[model samples]
Target: MRGDGARAWLDEGLKLLAEQGAPAVTLERLCERMGMSKGAFYHHFGSMPKFRTRLLAHFEAEYTTAIIDAVEGAGGLTARERLERVVAEAVKDTGPGLEIAMRAWAKQDPEAAAVQERVDATRIGYLRGLCEEAGHATPSRMATLLYLALIGGAHLMPPLPPAEMREMYGVLLPLLD
Candidate 1:
């Protein structure tokens, strides 16, 4: 009841970004989608730039940091096990539209670019650590390959389905061994 209005804006705005890309996340479009008003948007975010920053932050936290935390914080898990957890999270998250859109936005917006760079570095670093822990000889290369596969899958026209993604990633399991 309290922050529900702002939360609605965030959730709906995320959907808009995923389905329609960052350009489609304007105040007019988000309000149109939510059947709300500028007053309400301002009530929650105070300004569009503030809202965009919040939206990007939410995406990074939810899609990146949260997954990393879940996998790494699970305790007693091996490097391969941590990767398996990431795969599982991939299937359960909101698919790849947001990922693709964020990456594309990074090409045009400095703020998004900064966030994207951090995310890329953080993820690849995480994967490299996992590979090293698993005794992979070329951890950085292996990690980059793994990350590239995930991003490539996002760029697919219809986007790859979750089961297919899992299967695709499964093919790399042998490399870990």
Candidate 2:
């Protein structure tokens, strides 16, 4: 409870979710992982519902908003260039594990499903804009395909390596052009 306990809970919860899925994200599990107690969690989150909501927000901030901000803030990058950079960065980020877990959680939890829907839409929207900038024949369709491929790859047994992912993007570039 001394320093940013709420963030600690969120971070641990995300780890549990990634490793063991949403069902493992209970307060007991998080507290055990953090070596804290229920009182400490209650001090920050008040209740399970509050904790769940904040956890989702934290995931969105860390996984989606941060990446978007980073891509947008990179000076002189064209939309296509930005898109490539975002995908490359994602290949290195641990957020994909959380994403894959969240997708599984979405099937049983409406709130998780709603958050997943919004996240997917926001990402696809950005992809669509980039596709339009790159002059893809059908930006919407192309964006959907690209997003699906990325999401589908996240579910792979070993996940795609960064080099292989870059190669995939290379193969995708001419199609976008």
Candidate 2 stretches with Cα past 4 Å from truth are 1-3, 93-95
Residue-level lDDT tens digits of model 1 in 5-71: 7768888888889899998899988878888778988999999999999988887887789889988
Best by TM-score: 2
Residue 118, model 1: Cα distance from true site in angstroms: 0.7
User: Model 1: C-alpha RMSD to truth?
Assistant: 2.1
Residue 57, model 1: lDDT of: 87
> In candidate 2, which residue pairs get closer than 3 Å at backbone N, Cα or C atoms, i.e. clash?
none
lDDT of 2 by residue, 7-67 (tens): 8889888888999998888988887788888899999999998999988888888888888
Reference-based lDDT, residue 87, model 2: 78
C-alpha lDDT of residue 140 in model 2: 96
lDDT of 1 at 69: 93
